[model samples]
Target: MKSYLGLIPISAKVHRRQNRMTILCIVFAVFLVTAVFSMAELGVRIEADRLLEKHGSQELENLAGSTMAQTLYPIAAVLTLLILIAGVLMISGSINSTVAQRTKFFGMMRCIGMSRQQIIRFVRLEALNWCKTAVPAGVALGIMAAWLLCAVLRFLVGGQFSEIPVFGISITGIVIGSVTGIAAVLLAARAPAKRAARVSPVEAVSGNEKGTGALRHGAKLCLFRVETALGIHHAVSAKKNLILMTGSFALSIMMFLSFSVLVDFVGYLMPQYSDASDIDISGSGGADTVDSGLLDTLSGMEGVKRVYGRRTSFQVPVEISGAAEGFGAAESSGAADLISYDDFGLDCLKKDDMLKKGSDISKVYGDSGYVLATSDADSLLRIGDKVKIGAEELEIAGLLKYDPFSSDGLTHGEVTLIMSGETFIRLTGITGYSLISVQTTGNVTEEDVEAIRAAAGEDCVFSDRRDQNTSGTYRAFAACVYGFLFVITLVTVLNIVNGISMSVSARTKQYGTMRAVGMDGRQITKMIAAEAFTYALSGCAAGCAAGLFISKWLFDVLIAAHFAYAVWELPVNSLLVILLAVILAAVLAVWAPAGRIRKLSVTETIGEL
Candidate 1:
């Protein structure tokens, strides 16, 4: 060899089996960054097209630079950072275990006059060498995943995503993934490399260089069996390894909990109502000219599931009773938007659980002199307050959790009073509806829409929004969040399994000695299981404690701050699911290692490593 540096590739080649976990970590990190950024690019493209089509070029330009439009990049960046951290933890643990096993090899190099800097370079270069194959494989897998996601959005979703290219390549994604993979591998190799250089030649050559702290006391045998207690001791004996393993498991849970908040944020951002219409019919010039009888006509149609209409009068004068006067009533000249809902509309509201606590939907369902109001943070309106319109005084029997009309859940300076259609007609002396909405059956066709259009005549405006429902945004968001969660879970499980297997391999000689001392295979297996469980239990406790606070913080920032109606609650179901996953991972992690230990030839294992 020309120089000691030439041994780097040879070392990696000889230790290929042990290096697989490190390579996998790099691949996973690269894949995540590539897939996420690629999907973000596609999503931005799809959203831009939809906006450009809905509004003209001038309006599109205005919205293109808006804060909402620029949110995707920051979100993608955060996800990339999380994936990077996970990669570092997994890869570092793997390399540390490898170094502990190869103490003699590094010690020999040091004895042959290898400088510490050269040893560090050799270890780092060995790690980088694996990236030659890992990076390309990861990028390829990432591109395929992005293509698959695009296909799902375009074919299955089929709304605003119809124009997205299924097989498109994103240069930005490719570059970012490659760079992140290299960076993660380099960062992960640093501490292990330095530790390897610090290995003492005399201890390593004498075969006493097993990297573990001397125990200050014996295992607590009273609480557990001999085998289990020994296994727990083995786990806790290596303080660094214990920390790495626990951190890997805990980070996975934390990331899962944090990402879950995004699902709720998306729900609020594109709030979908249970009564959302597939088709809408409204009067021209914002007038209540559409016949209210058309609601019944559409409801009876063959392809219609249900129908509802609203009679609305904007900025109607009103008189507020005591305690209701703080709703900016005096400044706005006692004006509020007056709206009336039919039985079906009120039923939809009840089904959607939009009514706040203590709401009484029954009184507002009929011609009773009780009405519902939409509230915001600053409003002083409450249930049981009186709102007088003209000569009639209507009691506020309920309040909506938010102003459904406003995107941010705020009323934006105007109070809204909602009542039954009969009460509205009695108060305003108007019988026509300003807007009518139709819910369609599963097999609804254009013929049904045309029939309804013919019934309403050309005087009323018609809109078909079946393919443009906002629920698609929710589905897309859910798919993305769950996809990320699945990847994180896979990485966590693999890290746990790999770490346990390495632990088993490093302690093979010890196991063989125990076997020679008459410890049976079952005892050995129990010992391994105990070790795995120790790691799992510690990780679970730490993960859940940190995850709960992070989940709440994310919820407060992403959902609660902007939307007055949103509140954080304990995610019991999420906690249960995460705990179940961690338990399953621990079981799986123990399986292969225990089996290998059970099948080991005691004499050969003792003589080999």
Candidate 2:
């Protein structure tokens, strides 16, 4: 051979089976990063098309300047960073395990006049060789995944996304994937390469290398049988290995929990309120001129699922009977918007969780004197407080969590008083509605929308929004989020399984010796399981603790800061699901390694290098 580097390919060829897991890790990491960026770019394109088609160039320019558009690329960048961190942890653990197994090989190189730097260079280059095949494969898979998602959005979800180009390829995705794959492998190889170079020739040649070293302490027998205790001992004895394994598992959990916040933010950004209508009929200049009888007429029409009407009186003078602490000092007179709701509208509020704590809907359901006020009406108005509008006194029976009419969850300097239609007519002596809304069934056709529009006549302003109900944006966003989450989950499972298998292989001789001394397959299986559980338990604890903080921070930034109505709470459901997943992963990780251990011949295992 011209140089020691010549052995790199030969060694990889000989150990290809052992290196396959490492290669898979690199491929998956590249795939995730590429697919995320690709999908994000496609989402932007699709949204732009929808805007240009529906609202023209001026509206599209306005959207481009909007906060949502400005934040889109930054969000994608953060997601890419998360994917990179996870990939590094998983790939580093795999490389470290491989180095530990090959201590003798590295030591032999050291003994043959190879310098420490040469050994390091050899290990790094060997890792890079795997990327030649892995990177291309990963990029291909990522492109195909992006195309598949585009096809789903374009053909399967055909409302706003019908014009999305399924065959469009993202050059940015390709370049990023190729670069990230190579960079990740190089970064992951650094520590492992350094450790490999540090192996002493004497210990390695004498077959007393670190991987086969005797335990510093005997397995404790207090908690379980000898086999299980030994397994646990194996996990904790190697501090570096334990840390790497635990970190790998922890990163997956953290990513899952952190990304879940994005789902909530998306909901806030594109809120589909419970009372949103497929068709709306409003009087000229928002006057209360639409007859209340129109509600029943629309409700009786074919394909109409439900109909509700609202009566609004803007900037009505109000008098507070109590301390009036809820009103600002400047607005002591309490200028408010008086609105009325029917039974269906009241029910919709309850269904949407719009009522604040301690709200009582029964008090305001009919002609009862109690009324509901928006939470922003006054900071100090509690249920049971009294307010006077005109000559009548009304009790505040409940408060809404937000102003459902306002998109930003703010009331914009006006208190909103909502009561039953009977109460509103009694107080204002007006039976007409300011606006009427209709919700149609899933099979609603254009003819149904036309008939409703024609019945409303030319006096009222009509709007048909059935196309908006198709939920194109919501589905596309959900598919992307869940798809990325699924990729993280798959990578995590593979990492756990690969790490355990490498650990088992490294201790083959030790396991064989135990089997020779009457340790059965079931005992071996228990021992392996105990070790896997140790990693899982530690990882879950650390991950959940860190994840909770990140989740809350993201919630504060993305949801709470923008929406006055959002509140943070414990993510109990996410915790339980992740815990269950970790436990199941631990169980599955032990299956193949234990089977391989059981099938090993004692003599061959003890005799083989």
Candidate 3:
């Protein structure tokens, strides 16, 4: 008797076509894992080296000892876990299908006095034979992918990471990728291998495979044409297989939608600037740098919609009675920043959608009313409460959430009090505006921005919100998301193609019988197309539903808890993209396999059995 190890090469060579998809699955998983890890490790190392050079080795060591291990390790671990899960699912699906197709072959081996252990070994070794080629190819692909990703990040985004080193092929990444890839393959093969070992010779010869079941009992009952009914019957024949195919397809769609939603939601919740303005012109120097003359000049500019300015005060003494720390020019109150806006400034805030909650500043323009900008939990004073800043006493009018020009700095930190122009003038007796805010009309052109900048002068700073650094960050993140989307999409397409091909290949005899009787190639292609459509419809519907829940959960956990209003918008574009892709995949999957079977003669097809 041939040793199981020796039989593996023969088995793998003979059934190479059947194992092709499984091999590709392993290859893709390993490639992604290695490339991602390599990129991540390289980034960390580069950052660490830069920090060490700038801050000295001791401080760098401390950062590495504390932050690097604490944060980076946890993220790496979680990423590794997710990749492993994906790998296992892909490999297991292929292995399960492979074993189902080879039931008769397994049973014949059993009849030749092969032990259960020998069968298991044979299956595992056959998978390993594919890995020998796949692992090296996967590693090489990973290196190339990492290099490409780095180049894109550096040249395309052009921001903070523009100078950072983006690529390094880490030995650690290679080892982890290779090890996890093989581990996932082995674990996935175990169940199918064991099942193959248990198949009886009698059952195999009788054509009673593990996944097969009773044929369509009542063909006329199906609510479709004969060809369509047969296609549907073929899909539902093995309920487990249907579920597996649909589930895998659904997960791919779900991941794409959920990740896209996360990117959009995060951008909304954590804005780069106060608002999405076309142009933002702030004085580079002190408030004195931007005088009333410049403000008038900017307001009258052609593309400028409105111009506003704010008088800012820092570390002013305040007294909040009944406070735990007895706030007095402290970080909680007076030491915090204060912004007083005129009526025009108030209008600008409203136009930019920066107001969270409060009546118009017009209501408190000349009154003693004040708006407190602090977290609800950490608020020292409530609405209607009187507080004394220096000599002027003011009542808390309302609460303002995160705003761009606040003491809390964009999202959260220290508290600031906002008051009307008159109230601000009457209280601190200051009259100069510190920050000049500008809003331009729709899609400000480069000439408009240059004109503004020229008017502001070289000494005074100018910013076009359209060209903010946050845009670079957003693009980088979006690219990363789309990269993941691409990977999952490729995997999904492969799964569909492999699944359809395997199903059609297994039914060669049935197709031959139909062709011999009367059915044409067009009818055969239509039947396969119908089957693919059913699977795509079922999978996409289920996936969209799951994606919505995931997006909401991600918003709640990542965004809502951190900042303000985490609204869950429908991922309409993402849904449309997923639907279109699924449809295309279904068509390609069915068309390719059906075309092959259609060209074969009845005798040649039946002879395949």
Point to the candidate with the largest TM-score.
2
- Please report, in order, the local distance difference test score of every candidate based on alpha carbons: 0.83, 0.82, 0.69
- List where candidate 3 sits over 4 angstroms from the true fold: 1-4, 39-82, 151-163, 198-211, 214-216, 219-222, 261-402, 407-474, 553-568, 603-609
Which lDDT tens digits does candidate 2 get at residues 1-609?
A: 997788988988999988998899889878877887787677667677777888888777676665555666666676667667777778888888788778878788778788899888988999899999999999999999998888887787787677778889988888888888888889888988888888888856644456445656699999899999999998998888888888888888888887788778777777757788888899985679998888888889988999999998888888866645547454446678889999988988888778888999889988888999887633566788888888888899898977777776777656789999999999888899899999999898889889999889899999887677746666777777777777777777777888888877777777888887789999999999999999989899888988898889889877887887788878887777777878877889899989998998977755654
Q: Which candidate, 1 or 3, would have the higher TM-score against the true structure?
A: 1
Clashes of each: 0, 1, 0
lDDT over C-alpha atoms for residue 139 of model 1: 96
The candidates, ranked best first by lDDT, are 1, 2, 3
For model 1, how does the per-residue alpha-carbon lDDT over 1-609 read when each residue is reduced to its tens digit?
Answer: 999988888888798888888888888889888988887777667667767888866766675575554666766787677778777878888888888788888888888898889889988988889899999999998899888887877887777677778999989899999999999889989999998988877856554464566658988899899999999999988888889888878877887787777777777787778889998999986768888888878889879998888898888988777554455635323788988898978988899878888999999877789999998667688888888888898899999987887767788767898899999989999899899999899898889888988988888899988877867667766787788778777777787889888878778778878887789988998999999989989988988898888889778766786777786878887788777888888889888878877887877865755
Worst 10 residues of 2 by lDDT: 323-332
lDDT of 3 by residue, 1-609 (tens): 456477777778898878889889888878877866776675577567667778888766566565444544444554565556656766776787777678788888889888899889888877777889888888888888777766776787665556655555678779988987898889878877887888888866744474465554845534788888778777777676677677767766766665575466436634644334565555676653466578788889878887777777775666554444635445345555677777765655566545445534445555455654443444455556566777766666655544455433353445577777667767777676666777777666778878888998887767666545466556665666577678767877887777777767766667777887789988898888877787788888887887678767666655665554344557788788778888888888888778877887987755645
lDDT for predicted candidate 1 compared with the true structure: 0.83
Poorest lDDT segment (10 consecutive residues) of candidate 1: 324-333
Count: clashes, candidate 3 = 0
